[model samples]
Each structure stands twice: as C-alpha cells, then as structure tokens.
Target: MRVWAKSGVAFNGVIAVVVGLGCALFALMAGLAWPAIVATSVALAGIAWLMTIRQDIRRHFVVKHPFPDEWHEILNRSVSFYRKLDEPAKRRFERDVQIFLGEQRIYGVEGQEVPIETKLLVAASAATLSHGRPDWEWGRTRDIVVYPKAFNDEYDVADGAKIAGMVQEHGPILFSDRDLKYGYQRSADGYNVGLHELAHVVDLEDGRADGIPGDLNWMAAMPWTDRIHKDLTNKHGRHLKRLLGNYAYTNEAEFFAVSVEAFFERPKKLEQRDPELYRLLSHYFNVDPRTGRVIEPVD
Candidate 1:
C-alpha cells in the first residue's frame, strides 16, 4: 500500500510538471519569452498549490484530540470503520479533518471550553461526509459553531423552521455538540446533525438550497434526483421500513444530507438495500465507499 501510494504521488507530480511546462510554453508564446525561468517559476507555484491543497484536504478529514494516550484507543475504536479508506483517501481525509476542526469554535452554554475529543468526533464525521468531493463548496465555509449541548436560538417560526444547526443564507453554521458527538460515536446510526446541516450548505452551492447541488451537471443531477426520490418513496411507502432515516423524508435537502451520512457511515448496508441510490451518490461524489476507490463511471 505504501508503494502504491508513493507511485500515485509520483504520478501526480509528473502531471503537475507537464502542466507547468504547458503553462510556461503558453506564456512564452504570449510574449513572456523567458521559457526556462517562466517554466521553473510556474512549476514551483504548481507544487506549492498542490501542497497547500493537500494540507487543506487532510485538515478536513482527521482530527487530533488533546487527551491522554488511553483516550486515543477509545477514539480509534469509535471510528474503526474509517479504516475502509485507502492511504491516499486517508491523507486527503486528514487534511480535510484538520481544516474542518480548525474552523469551528466549540463552547459550553455557560461559555466554558468543550473537550477537544468531543469536537474531534464531530469534525471527523463532517470530514467523512465531505471527503468524496475535492471540489465541494462547503469546504470553504470555515468556522463551525458547536454548543456543548442542545441549545436554542431565536428563529422566525413564520419563516422556514430552524432545527439544531442552520446554514443561513450567508452565515456561520450552528451545531449542537452533544447531538453531533452522540450521533458519530454511535457509528452514525441515526441522523447526523452535522452532516445534515453541512448537506444543506453543499446544496446551497448552486446558489440555492433547493435540494439540488447546482454544481452537478444535468446528467448527474437527473440520476441523483431520481434515485433519491425512488428510495424515499419506497421507504416512506412502507415497502422498505426505512433504509435511511425518518428525517431524510422531511424534504429534498434533508434527504441529500441524510443520504451522505449513510453513504460514508454504512456504505455496504446502503448498497445492499438501495443500490441505485448508492450508485448515484458514488457517481456524484466521484468516490465509491464500498471500494474506497475513485474511477470514472462507464456510460
């Protein structure tokens, strides 16, 4: 696995080099005649970008807790399922995890600092859900506000109802730390409030949270909608007692978020129960949880 991972990194390096050369040649043609100097500068810039992105990605997927060694064992046991990810994916996950954790400020209702382990668990789950897409828009929405426990905020009930955490039209995310920690520690069995809310953030990427990722082209969007709707109907109609969760059936946006949690937390179960929905998610995310591999889908 290490050799394979090394080879993959080398391959990416080669590609980056080729792209750098191409950019330099283009610049020369456009009158920046210093080919050698230009190529070298561009190559260095490319390398820097790649490194930055790698760190950013790792920050989004892995979290480090300030606890004793014994606690590490417990956290590992809690997230043992994450071993399904290959090294490259794990690297990316680590970067994303760090990024996710770095952004959030966790506090108790009384304004005390929450335990790092609690925040780590919540951030880990968020990283797992968002890891599939390197281009995920929510990746840029730094700062997750986690309450030590379930807390409430003033909401305009007349407008859309606000649950635990909400992704405002243009605002930071709100989360119940107690709910997030409990949900992820329990093997992500029930609805993940973190993922649920993050899903809403991703859906808003297309400029509106209308239950659609506008970033998805029509081809991807069609299948995504079809499979999700079919699964929802089957589960809600009593034919399938609920492969996802009841919250998923609340609306299209919630359904997308709920599906994301299931995709990462229980890939095999989801595949066994709803193959089509699994396939759609795998396609859109460009990663297959079942195989921990990224390959283009054949038409």
Candidate 2:
C-alpha cells in the first residue's frame, strides 16, 4: 500500500514537472515575449496547484488514527477483506479511508467517550466500499456526529414534532455507536447501515439523494435509470425476491443504500438473484466484492 501511494504521488509529480518544463520551453521558443512568459507562468502555476491538490487529497483521505498497536492489529484482522484490492486500489482505498475520517468529527454525546479507533474502522470500511469510483463527489457530508447510544432530538414541523436519526436538513450523518459497531462486526453477513448511509451520499453526487446513481453523462444516466427501474419493478412483481433488505423499498435513496450493503456484504446472493443488477453495480463501482480478490471473506 505504501508503494502504491508513493507511486500515485510520483506519477502526479512527473506530470507536473513535464508540464512545467514544456511551458518554459514554449516561452523560450516564443522569443521571451511578455505574453508568452505570462502564459507559460500560468501553465506552470496550474501544474503546481494540481500537485498541491493531490497531496492534500492524499493527506485527507489516508487513515492515521492514534490507536494502540493492539487496536491496529484488531482493525487489520477485521478488515482482512481489504486485501482483495490490487496494489493501486489498495493505496487508493487507504487514502479514501483517511479522507473519510479526516472529514468527519466524531463526538461523544452522552458523557461516554467513543474510541477514535472504533470510529476510524467504521468510516474506513464505508469509504473502502466506494473507493473504486474516484469521480464520485460528496463534499456536503462534512462530519459524523456519533452518540454513545441512540439519542433523541427535537425538530419543528407543521404540528411541531421531534425525531431521532432523521438526516438533518443539511448536516452531518448521525449514528449510534452501538449500531455502528454492531453493523461493522456482524454486517459482513449483509446488514451495514454505515455503508447504506454512505451509499445515499454517493447517490447524492448528482445533487439529489433520489436513488439515482450519479453517472458521468446523460447517456450513462439513461441506462442506470432503466436498470434501477427494471430491477425494482422485478422485485416488486415477486418475479424476484429482493436481495437487498426490505428497507431498500422505502425510497430511491434507501434502495441505493441498501443495495450497496448487499453488494459489498452479500455479492454472491445478489449475483444469483439479479445478475443484471449485479453487473450494473459492478460496472459502476469498478470492483467486485464477490471475487474475494481485493477483500477476503471473514472467517
């Protein structure tokens, strides 16, 4: 993973250097004209900016939790599934884990201190699940507010009411630590609310958490919508029992999240029940958890 991370940095550095030198040469060939110098400088500046961005991204996305050595071993053991990634993907996954952790601020709400390592493990697992798609952008979720246990909150409505765990109007994701830890440890069997929520974040990449998997273009979006509609309808018809949880049927966003949990936790089942849906997810995610190549199954 270290080698892979270094390689990414090296690759970006080489590109920056090449572009910078090219601009300098272009300026010289243009007879040192003021316009040419300015253009070359701007080009060089752009390369430098990109290099800084890459470094910052790496720093933000890579996990560096200050846990005890024993805790590190425990996390490494729990996530043995991560090994299925190829070298490059593994490094990228590490980087994403770091970014997820760095972006979120976890607080102990009930005078019960939550271990940072525990939070890191949960966030890392969720981030690793989506590392394949580097293009998916979800900057709105800036933090993860965790309660030691399930807690309640008050909110205003038409009749003035209160809710718990209701994803706020525009704020961080909130999860009970108990639920998060349980989902992490046992959900390898297929129930992962963390991954489910993160999937909603990914689906929101297109600017709405409406169950539409954000695609790069209109043509891509068309096929994605068709696939989702067909799969959901087929499941509804009893032609196919839903491989994803019943919660998935709640809405588009929930469907996307629940589907993600099934994809990562029960890939073979999804493959058997809905081959087309499995294929679509595999293509979009660029990784197949069922292969056991990047992340090995837990014993």
Top lDDT prediction, candidate number: 1
Q: State the local distance difference test value for candidate 2.
A: 0.61
Alpha-carbon error at 249 in model 1, in Å?
Answer: 1.8
Candidate 1 residues lying further than 4 Å off, grouped into runs, are 1-75, 103-111, 137-142, 153-163, 229-241, 291-299
lDDT of 2 by residue, 66-164 (tens): 334664455565554455556655555665565655555666654457686667765665655556555444463556666555555532221322222
Q: Which window of ten consecutive residues has the lowest lDDT sum in model 2?
A: 155-164
lDDT score, candidate 1: 0.62
After the best TM-score superposition of candidate 2, give how far the Cα of residue 168 lies from its true spot, in angstroms.
Answer: 4.0
Residue 185's C-alpha lDDT in candidate 2? 77
Q: lDDT score, residue 296, model 2? A: 24
Error of 1 at 182 (Å): 0.8
What is each predicted model's overall lDDT from 0 to 1?
0.62, 0.61
